[model samples]
Target: MMILSWRRRRGGHRTSKPAFVEDNPGMDLAIPTHFLCPISLDLMKDPVTLSTGITYDRESIEKWIEAGNEICPVTNQVLENFDQIPNHAIRRMIQDWCVENCARGMERIPTPRIPVAPRDVLEICSKIMTATQRGDHKKCMELVEKIKRWGRESERNKKCIIENGSGCVLSALFESFSSISIQEHEYLLGETLSLLIWMFPLGSEGQSKLGTAPSLRCMAWFLKERNISSCQNVILVLKELFSSDEKHVNAFAEIEGVEEDLVKIVKEQTCPKSTKASLMVIFHLISSSTSSEKTISIFLELGLVSLVLEILAGPERSMSEKALRILDSICNWEQGIKKASDNALTMPVLVKKILRVSNLATDFSVSAILKLCKSQEGGDHQQVEALQLGGFHKLLVLLQVGCGEKTKEKVTELLKLLNQQRGRLDCFDSSMDFKYLKRPSL
Candidate 1:
């Protein structure tokens, strides 16, 4: 089947024939069968012959090869090599045909340059390595931009770049630059970060290398930068690195201002994806039992408790669940409990989230509330607030509908607290609905 290939030209026009036809609809000239690219079914501009003895547009064949297809699309035979030889004869014929039909709105295809090859990508990486070794910031910047441009040119170029160890080279460069003050190399570092983001999924190995403490410190600095894209990239890179392996979390959390920057991202609600990534990273950093106390202290100091409560009250289910999980972790600390209970939205958000999102979210919500009520000094006030927020009914319904033993235990404990306090507190609204509230024989 034929597919359209899109490319950007010098003047911002697309190279796709369909786009051309859309712009010049009056041109209804029929193209010769031999003049058309077999893959795209458009007149071949840069015809190239493959090892399988078949001809296809250079861009299409290169895309196919870069996509890891080794068999000829037309011959159904295994390809011996990926090298493509330009068919000058057919290209000339097509160009001449376009000229003859120029009055009919036919446009001639420009001559094609040699597509980026694996060797070409390796050479660029070599230059970048040399420039880094020599501390040639200007040369490194130029090479990085060149590579970035090639990445933007075609998927084939991107594949070639990655396959030729560009990821490793870039990781090394980023790490080396991270040792110095970000001010010394702001633009270069920012560009490198942007490039790294574009070449995501740096595989496990690349991510592992970048998951180091130095790299994490660099990431934290990037987060503090005024450049929004740089901050986003740092979040994304940290997400990928931490998600790949959790062993890096402890070191990452220890970085100064890491938690602060992450909290800011969630608090400000910059972008949904980054906000979620920030949440997950926060969860990872504090989820560890060994680091929970210290990490929670750091987060609590940054007003994370209030931010988490606000997020739980939000409309995004995924972000809410993530925020709730962080809340559960935060409540493990005494200070976290104090900060959480002080937040006006804590009880209401937690009660509303019970049975509201998913099983996991329900677990987090119930656990967070349990921790708060049990640990907080003014337990009576929280218990009263829980009842006022219909938390008692929700707990009753939770027991009736069933849940994990741990969650049920928490519900039973919290329900007992609420019921025990319900008698003493006259603030409970008797008119509140209890149709779904089924009292378990506690």
Candidate 2:
């Protein structure tokens, strides 16, 4: 409505203006051309001029530069330098424009403070390095907190922290604290772990260093801490480390009580993120080549089957997917099959999820069901249970929708297994009779 009123100004003559588009693409407002940032095509909140003679919103341009783009977004020319001069005149113009239209629900953008520079990040990292080496816990944590603030400030600040190799310093700080007892430095460990995970997908060097037994052991100990944030960060870092190198899996397997803590995180459902991370960690541990047997044994002893069944029965999608994958992975063993089959929900839940959740879920569910059926000595009872639960129908739907070759193969074998049972011959007649006999008997 304000835009319509603005269009009728100056003796009822409409002023041709460039329309604002980015934030609200559908609304074509009479926004001044000079008020917009070329990159975002939106009103510039903090206009800054680049050396390439182009002015853009500071946040947008900083993100572009930090993303390693050498050419300007507007100019498309090679950047000789990365200096952004504040466009004070343009900023003032935008502010005045907003002020003129303040009665129309237009809000003014606040002035942005000076951004953190690479030199600033490097200086703080230097202080961290020195403080860490000097064994100054107070100053070290203070500096680490400062770095964390900078990192949380913006993506540009995070890039600066990473580009300046803060990971090197942070990992060193972690190792230094690892040798110390967590009980004495719980706060320090929480802060360091949070920051380390913040700058995740650590460089190869950092990964190799942190993936060591001692580093992992220290992290595992941190898992037992009562701090929820610390547990989330430690599990996330562990996920990253395990993802980077499979050897960490075996190393983690050797750590006592680590699996218990991970299972507890899932059982208690501390947070959705931590639960998913915990499940991922377990999946990786089970996927390990050399230590998988021991890992499976430990997880089974910890009641993982029941826990996974509980997760699957919940309404969460991603967690259920991860839990199903874990179940399928573990089903290769007879003990895994026995544990899964012993649970009442295993067949019913797996059958319910077959064609219901997702393709991956269906694949896993089908695989687990096939394993359970085959694991039985008579196989008749399990097949009958599967057929009674409509596994046969779900598998047909799965085949129609299509699945992977392996999953298709598994489904085919499972269909044959269900079909060989006593109910298969009369399935069609039984279904028809049930439908026709829907009327209540008097």
Candidate 3:
């Protein structure tokens, strides 16, 4: 059972021939069977010979590796190693075959360049660092562009770059951003940040180094730049750098205007991915119990409460969930409770999002409202507003719907609080049974 494949011509037409058409009535062209990859059944662009004596395209084999296969596809034998040796001989033959069949509408395949080796990547990065240190801006920029191209060219090159101390090199480059002139800083730092984002998932040590005072200053500069890409990259890198590191989180919060800039990004940036990245960073920083009162005040003054309310009102479930979680974190603090309680929209949004987004979102929203209602700052107006916004009905629904234990507890507490004030509130429906408001046992 053989398959026939069509090769597209330069004039936007395709020509097909049987796999083994030695003598056809109308056509005589035959494509060599071995010229096609076994996996894709297509002509190989960059043919690579595996250990099991099978030749496949580089991309196909890499995808196989990425799929967690540890053996050759054709032979089903354990591969000695995953090294993909370029089959230049077979590649040349394929190119020659394409050239010969060009008149028959076959497109000629160009020769693939040898992939950059780890040693070469290491040396180029070393030269880049030396050039940067020597103030050879032109040389440094050129090498930086080359590395960027290499990183973007193939995952193989990126892996090679990362394996050969690219993290340390990037950390050094990020640190140098503070010393560069303002005119050149944007271009250089922009290029460096783009590279960093590409080669992310940095090690803990590398992350700590990159989160230094100088690198953070450079990131601050990125936020102020008119280039939106740099701003997005800054948030992404910070998100990775600050994950699970309390020291880095504290350091990041201490960056002058960092919180304000993050709030601005959430409000003004149109890219949802970047906005989420900014939100995650903000969540990590403000969620920390170690976050100072001054830090909380800074966020409040920068309108974090209003921004979160606006996001919760939107239709994105993920963003709303994240916003709710951040609200829950901040609301634990006295300052956060006061700020969220003061905002007219916070209580309403909290009540609306419960059971509307997801279980996690429901839990966080319930927790935020509970904190606000328990606070001494939550006066009659806020409490009445919650009830008017159908808070009591939502609590009853949440109890019946079987939410998490903690959520049930919070709902019960909120229901009890509202029940106490029910006589004075017109929105409360007293006709409904209140038996379901009993708190769940621990």
lDDT (Cα, tens digit) per residue for candidate 1, span 82-175: 7799899998988887778655445677877666888898898899989888878899999999988888877767877877888878887887
Question: 1-442, model 3: which lDDT tens digit per residue?
Answer: 3334342212222346433232433454566778777877777889999888899988889899889999999999999998889999999998898878776556678777778888798798789778768877677778889888887777788888888888778677667755666456667767888888766677776776687877777787778764788898888888878774667788767778887788888998579989999999988888776678888888888888888888888888889888888899889888888888877788878887777778888899888878787788655666677888888887887788688787788888888888777888765665777455433322
- Estimate, for each residue in 1-442, the C-alpha lDDT of model 2 and write its tens digit: 1233332233221224323333344553466877777776667888999888889988779778878999989879998998999999899888887777554445566776667888898898899889878878889889889888887777767877888888878888777767666567668867888888877777887787677766788888878864788889988998888887887788778888888899989999979888899999999888667556767888999999999998998877788899999998888877787777778888899998875677778778888888888985635667888888877777776776668999999999988888778445455333422222121111
lDDT of each: 0.78, 0.78, 0.78
Candidate 2 TM-score to native: 0.79
What are the models' TM-scores? 0.77, 0.79, 0.83
The residue-level lDDT of candidate 1 at 441 comes to 30
Lowest summed-lDDT stretch of 10 residues in model 1?
4-13
Which prediction has more favorable TM-score, 1 or 3? 3
Give me the displacement of residue 69 in model 1, in angstroms.
6.3
Q: How accurate is candidate 2 locally (lDDT)?
A: 0.78
Question: Over 4 Å off in model 2, which ranges?
Answer: 1-44, 52-55, 60-79, 87-109, 292-294, 376-378, 423-442
Output the worst ten-in-a-row residue range by lDDT, candidate 2.
433-442
